[model samples]
Target: MRFVRLAADYPVTVFGLTFEKLLIIGVIAVFLLGPERLPHYAAMLGKFVRSVRDFANGAKDRMREEMGPEFDDVDWQKLDPRQYDPRRIIRDALSDADPFAEPATPVVARAAVNENSAYLQRKRKREALGAGDAAPFDSEAT
Candidate 1:
């Protein structure tokens, strides 16, 4: 037996950068910045990262506060933008139809009306008369 991994099972990489690649980038940055400016830039980068982290955490906390208990009930995976598909959305909406509710169009009346239509009447007559015979071709139609 073989195990198939889903898309969600794979670990996501930022710009496909590994630790070795990031170390190489850091070395290049250090050479470019030099020892003097490197410390200042590193401190600034740390501060920027901390601020961004705080901002994200604050937003999450704010959302939790606003939503109250419903925040935990939200299906985060379903809301992911990557999984979004208009066809899937429409299919789900259609599948969630109320079984007990009345249909938008009356099936019996629609069928009766369709049987009375001139086109249907002609088709039925044609089918009944034709049986296994080939359909009559009109050259004028072409």
Candidate 2:
């Protein structure tokens, strides 16, 4: 008899491991590990698996404690690699370029002339000793 478990990311499967695949892996392991040493190695493997599960659970609990219920509400599927289809991306990108929309370069072009603009004349004179373009980003200002 085979037992099936529902996975949050993969439905109708248990971490993508099936009974037949596990059986084949077990057979190969028995051959490689040998019957005499199989039990000892299996015990160690079990311990490692338990530790890994415990660590993952502990991390998840800690994250939940810090992030609150919103942590679980995060859309995990959006981060999946399968969601990024290049063909779909290119199509969307092509469609997103509105034919009637103004060009994006105007802001950058305006910024280029801003150094000599009336409002910045005083600052420009002061900074004339060492004029350099400073790109400032404020994370907290957001």
RMSD in Å for all candidates: 10.5, 18.8
List, residue by residue over 9-31, the lDDT tens digit for candidate 1.
65565689866788899899999
Candidate 1 segments exceeding 4 Å error: 1-25, 90-142
What are the clashing pairs of model 2?
none
True-structure lDDT of candidate 2: 0.73
| Backbone clashes in model 1, listed as residue pairs | none
* Reference-based lDDT, each prediction: 0.78, 0.73
Candidate 1: C-alpha RMSD to true structure equals: 10.5
Candidate that scores best on TM-score: 1
